[model samples]
Target: MSHYWDNLSARTNGQHTSEEFESAAYRLVVEQVIYYADRHSRATYWLIEGFERDFREALAPLGITLDVNRQLRYVYAKPQYAKAGTASVAQTLLALVLRALYDEGARLGQFTDDGEVVCDLVELEEKYRLMTGRELPGKGEFSELMRTMKRWGIAKKSDESLVQRGDSDQTLPYAVIIRPAIADILGEMALLRLAQWKELDHMPRIEDTESEDDHEVTE
Candidate 1:
């Protein structure tokens, strides 16, 4: 692995140093995902794509799988196993809901130039109720949850400063831009489990909700 890292560190001749690889790997693991469209991570995204094999080999021993979505221009790590309580029910349910909403938007051809779905919280709330028969968490809790979503590359608030102080400001952003990475996180199996949430009244364990190749419920 060090050999590969050393090779990568030298790939750019004098333009980059070993620390470049170290920094990129650190972000890849710690941030969990990177997208070419993200201004902050664009260079790291390219570096990972350029030396994907090296990154994969290095991450493998840690039981992490690198999923590079070339068409979508993003990459994320999947842990082979999840620790107990890695995700609260709120987090897991919300992620599954976002994945479903992304699919729904794709089916309707509603996408931005970046292939992301944009919708206000009203829609998200309705969908959450339709799938889980429960209201969303409180505003502060929802806000905190979105921070995790952003960190994982799943979704994000379109306007970070657009929060409204009252319910009348529904048109204000409370808007979420669902990234393509959401599909990679939850996949079709999450949709199937939505039916279970309705019919069986069961909140799936993280182990049960994972798509076949991924098992981590995320933090």
Candidate 2:
């Protein structure tokens, strides 16, 4: 994470503001980007929370909404089309859809009446199968991955919930946006593919830095 932050800082030339950093965090995470914050400083928390706030804000313009339970500290995102008073939906549309599916389980009494909706593992796998038209993974493997995703906020569970079925407790609310963060880099790879397929120079060309020999000759 730290390495990624360093790269991001260099790319931005140290011009990123708190809000920008937060928004960037969302974009990075949504794109499955990894970065490390200043572990030794208070900056880490600021960066994490700021990014979350900015992420939620980003969804607002896209007509998405989110709801955070102050008491339970649960966060929920959904489309803003019909739900006007709900919170902003700054996450990608793919994420929004997954969250809604998780929400359905919440409304269906998966948790205690007051508990929030985390995603149901079984349902999540089923949804994944449907989306990709592929076979789902075994329960154990999928559940473990889900928990890890939840911890990272790459995917999240409800903060509070009453266990409905002993085993089937929560529901999933977000899609894992980036499948292969390295293999499928967001900007460069996507742009390059577009340029090739579209047969146009859509991608911006980056100039290479001067070599040591060139620098020495110039000096």
Please give the TM-score that candidate 2 achieves against the real structure. Answer: 0.27
| CA shift of 127, model 1, Å | 1.7
Off by over 4 Å in 2: 1-68, 74-98, 106-110, 118-120, 137-144, 154-219
How high a TM-score does candidate 1 get? 0.79
Candidate 1 on 23-78: residue-level lDDT in tens?
A: 88889888887888888889999888988898898899989999888887888987
lDDT per residue (tens digit) for residues 1-219 in model 2? 445445545665577644545454454334333323113323433444444554455556666554433332233344435421221111122233344444455457554333434444455567654543434556565456555443334454443433445565553443332211112112233222222322322233112324222111000
Q: Rate the local accuracy (lDDT) of all candidates.
A: 0.79, 0.39
- The candidate that wins on lDDT is 1
Best by TM-score: 1
- True lDDT of residue 114, candidate 2: 32
